[model samples]
Target: MRFLRQSMIGVFLAAVSLGLLVYAAYVVQSAVQARLSDDAPAPPPRERVFAVHLERAEARTITPVMETFGEISSRRTLELRAAVAGRVTALHENFEDAGRVTQGEVLVRIDPSEMQAAVDRLSADLADAEAEIRDARRARDLAGAEQTAAEHQVSLREKAYNRQLDLAGRGVGSTAAVETAELQAAAARATVLARRQDVARAEARVDQAATRLLRQRIALTEARRTLADTAIEAPFSGTLSDTSVVEGRLVSANERLADLIDPNDLEVSFQVSTAQYARLLNPEGGLIDTRVLARLDVAGVDAQATGSLSRVSAGAGDGQTGRRVFARLTHASGFRPGDFVTLEIEEQPLPDVISLPASALGSDSTVLVNGEDNRLEVLAVTLLRRQGDQVLVRGEGLEGRDVVTTRTPLLGPGVSIRVLRQEAVVSAGVPDMLELSEERRARLVAFVKGTEHMPAETKERVLAQLAEREVPAQMVARIESRMGG
Candidate 1:
């Protein structure tokens, strides 16, 4: 009976323990499901991050670069116009289409037969006039001789009349003799008057002949000049750009023969805004005579020419407010007028600026800078200028700091970045110990500063930094000076 009671008691205890164990398992399962439901929903899919290369902004002496587009034109241009109406007879060796020519060089000869004939006719007329003048002179000389002879006859007749009078008075002369002497004297006087009239008439004829000869001589000169005009000549040295006439072809008076361009007198014409003009036009601006260099690219020809600044328009063009300027070329060969060309001009430069590839700049005129927390931070940069593929920028904290050079569309503000960068020393005496981790560099820089008053600490930092890589003595001194001892 005692053994039976013990067995029963053991069975009861086993059942109780089995029941408690089942309850505890149910409770534990319920708690686990509740805990999982309450846990913060799995953090949203993490944003994608990109690795990039970084470079430190550099201190540079950047030149002010000006970029413009303009047209090429010749300073010396000429239009070949005919001087008179004539048929084209002969063309000079250099008178072909687009031929080259020099000043005072004949280009073509017109049909000068007509002009030559006119010249000959005028010459003959002048000869006739001169012969008439000579005859009039001879006639006048004969008239004068006759007048002198008539005067001598009159004197002789007077002497005879006086002698006849004395004879009559002495009663030895007859009345008939005295009367005859008087009559003779009177006839002689009348003859002298007639001779004088002839002389006057001859003088008048000579004068008239001289006037006619002078007029004929003038006509001869005009005819010769007209003949000379038959031969065409180049006004200045240049290449014949467009020629419309050919040898053995006839041309009209005042007709355009060709267009000439002086390659040696090439110039580049360009327009600029009013603000830009102010800088270039200031009397003290010093850009008036500044040398302007130009480059020309000829179409369909593998040739180029360089030029210099020659002149600026005195005033803006009518209805065009901008200033126009020109540059003279030294090597104008192989260049034609009215060609378009690109240009680069220099302007005033800003000091202490940084230049980088324009691609790195963002739309808002900002650039990505590596931040303190190893993240990207957008910083606003002031743009000084933009050239072809290059830009000059100025920012508050970009100096001596690493910046992302290339545009990274995937990288945004507050995003973490793993910059894979190489150590490159900046040229302008800026220390490039940036190879060290940001934290490590800051700590080392601080340590170097703290050692200024403590000779032992100074030596320690100097030796440690020197062991890794060389540090500039100037930087060490600067740190020591900044130490708040």
Candidate 2:
């Protein structure tokens, strides 16, 4: 009975398995038919719109400034040298390095005893020559008078000879008497010739004496000049530098004594690319005398001065490209020669030009402008000048148009755009201010005070600014950058 029951259970199990397989086959066939017969449409992709910052393109006269690195220098720097070799006898109270002096102030006095003695001896020689000239003139006069008397006697002798000849011709005079008169006339003629020779010698002596006197006068003038050279006077009011002379120091002719730097006559020299140089020229092709400003950074302190473009270097330096430019400072307080500085040169006013952020310019010399329906349109523009973070450009149909402040690869012509932010055109002026922590302020103050090259007034001003509640952000950045903090 157990074996029969087990057989019945196995047969039931087999039937159930066959029925499950048949159901699975029917479901797979139905799924295949549905997938082959299905018809569905895909949804179209939506166009992408980019949001960017925009600024209005306004046409206005904007002066572009070219900023470059430079060096501060004095245009009226002079090298003080010893004109004559001698021992320095005395020195000015301020004859030292960094000493202030005035024009015509004697700075050095070389030993003048030798020069003075030379002058005295030349003067005496000149006086002796003058006296000799006077004596020669008197002698010439006496010789002339003697020559005249001799000529008179000759005339008398000739008259006597003529009378004797007349007597002889009448046969009333002896031959010996006529011969004697003839001999006397010949001797008187010889005396006249001798007197004429004396007069010539006297004239020659007078000429020699006059020449000697002229030579002596020239020598005296030279000696006086030498004596004057013993006292070295300042040519202009300025400060002394590189002083190498002192009292009792022996110096040679043309030896450098010091450097006279006209602190008031300050200038700055800088360089610019050829393209930039071309734009700084006037319509006549000459460099325009544009306004400039020089700034020197000493630690955290800045020394600023106003100036004008003066001249350009004739040649580009060796192994250098572009032009070297110079500017004359008007009030260059706290500036010293050889100090590295920054120069801001203002170019000519550009009319009908729009100033835009430098990022707005595209590599293809084009800019993106907002068109109708908030779409971007590429506009060709002429890039006039680049002023630090800004660019001056001009283009047709760009005025009064909304321009993209920055360009991106995703933005192009006919592309839809949304302005995330709009900014009005702002002029570049003074730097923004920032509040500093106590530690930062103290650090900057310490740096400014410790700067050896910084002027006292400049340091005080800088300290005053640091002491305030807020400081110039630019100044802080510069100071921190130099401090490597």
Candidate 3:
């Protein structure tokens, strides 16, 4: 009975200890939940402010420019062709591609031996004809002299017949003598008529010789002309291209030898949309002489020229949507045919217009302008022209106000903005020179040297820059951009 009572006491003590532990765990859980619910903070409100680039709108007269790509061409181009079939005997010292030639300069010489021989033969024939003409003239003179002698004999016979008739009439001569005198006069007259016919025949022979002489002279002149054609002379001062003829090369008549292009007389041919084409014309429906600047970027080198709008194509080309236009280049010294160039044509100036970055203009010609209290205001603008990265716009209440240069979807009317000033605009100064490594400098130098299409002057300038210890940052960036770096 004592052992059973001790067991009961131990069990009761174990149960009480278990209940106390469970109650302490429940109180700790409640205290932790209450602390959490009391310490958690509320969520903050969302901010509507956005950071953007901004530029002040200044209204002024802006001249819009239309940019287009074009190919350089020569207004005067000639195909040098052979006029006679012969072997090329001689070539000028500068008779090669890109060779400079003056007007009337003999560019190539064909074998003139054959043509010379023909000319000599024709000349000999002409001489022979001339000699024959002289001989015929002498013969004609001799025939005339014989006719004169025969006429004298006829006159003498007639006088004798008259005398015989008178003697017979006076009874101092016999009738037979008078009749014989009359017969003699008749025979003399027949001899005179034969001499006259001989003179006529001789004259006809002389005329025939003269005609033959004329024909022979004509033949000689033609042969001489052909001989002259053997020496191909430059029609005008130009540069030679597409040269195919060389010394000892046999060529046929009318074979193309080379192409001659007047480098000074160069033009740019480009195509523009119908609307742009219409804007390039004057009120008279003719192409306006708008000033144009053409630029060719060759291997990071820029070659520029100035010109004026010349004409428009007479007919639209097949598979082309726009009108073709041509500009007459005034100074095209470094330009060549087939060079693709960019042209910036000056259009009519717009009055009271604001020029801004293209990114500033939004859909439906709306722009975001910073309004009162630095809030964004959607302002409608009239987009006059889009030139490169800039747009010319005219709108009321835009002047003397700061307009956001860059737009984003998050930005809207009445939204607050934090202006991020652009260093490129705030400074508006020359770009700083950049320090380059030896490898980069060498690479640029090699690139400039390898650019065969670049103009010599531009290449030299670029090389000079590369030789310097530091190059302009902007220039380096431009070069790298062209190099696709």
For each candidate, what TM-score against the reference? 0.57, 0.86, 0.73
lDDT of 3 by residue, 164-211 (tens): 999988999999999999999999999999999989988998999999
Candidate 1 minimal-lDDT segment of 10 residues: 295-304
Lowest lDDT sum, 10 consecutive residues, model 2, at: 418-427
After superposition, which runs of candidate 1 have C-alpha atoms over 4 Å from their true positions?
1-36, 40-61, 102-104, 127-217, 282-287, 291-303, 314-321, 348-352, 359-382, 393-485
lDDT of 2 by residue, 322-407 (tens): 99988889878788888888888888888999988899999999999999999999899999888788899999999988889988
* TM-score computed on alpha carbons, candidate 2: 0.86
Total clashes in model 3, counting residue pairs 3 or more apart in sequence or in different chains: 0
Residues 52-124, candidate 1, lDDT per residue (tens digit)? 7787788777767566778878887888887778788887687765577889998878999999999999999
Write down the RMSD of candidate 3 (Cα, Å): 6.1
Clashing pairs in 3: none
User: Where is model 2 more than 4 Å wrong at Cα?
Assistant: 1-6, 13-44, 168-172, 299-301, 425-450, 460-485
Task: Predict model 3's lDDT versus the native.
Answer: 0.89
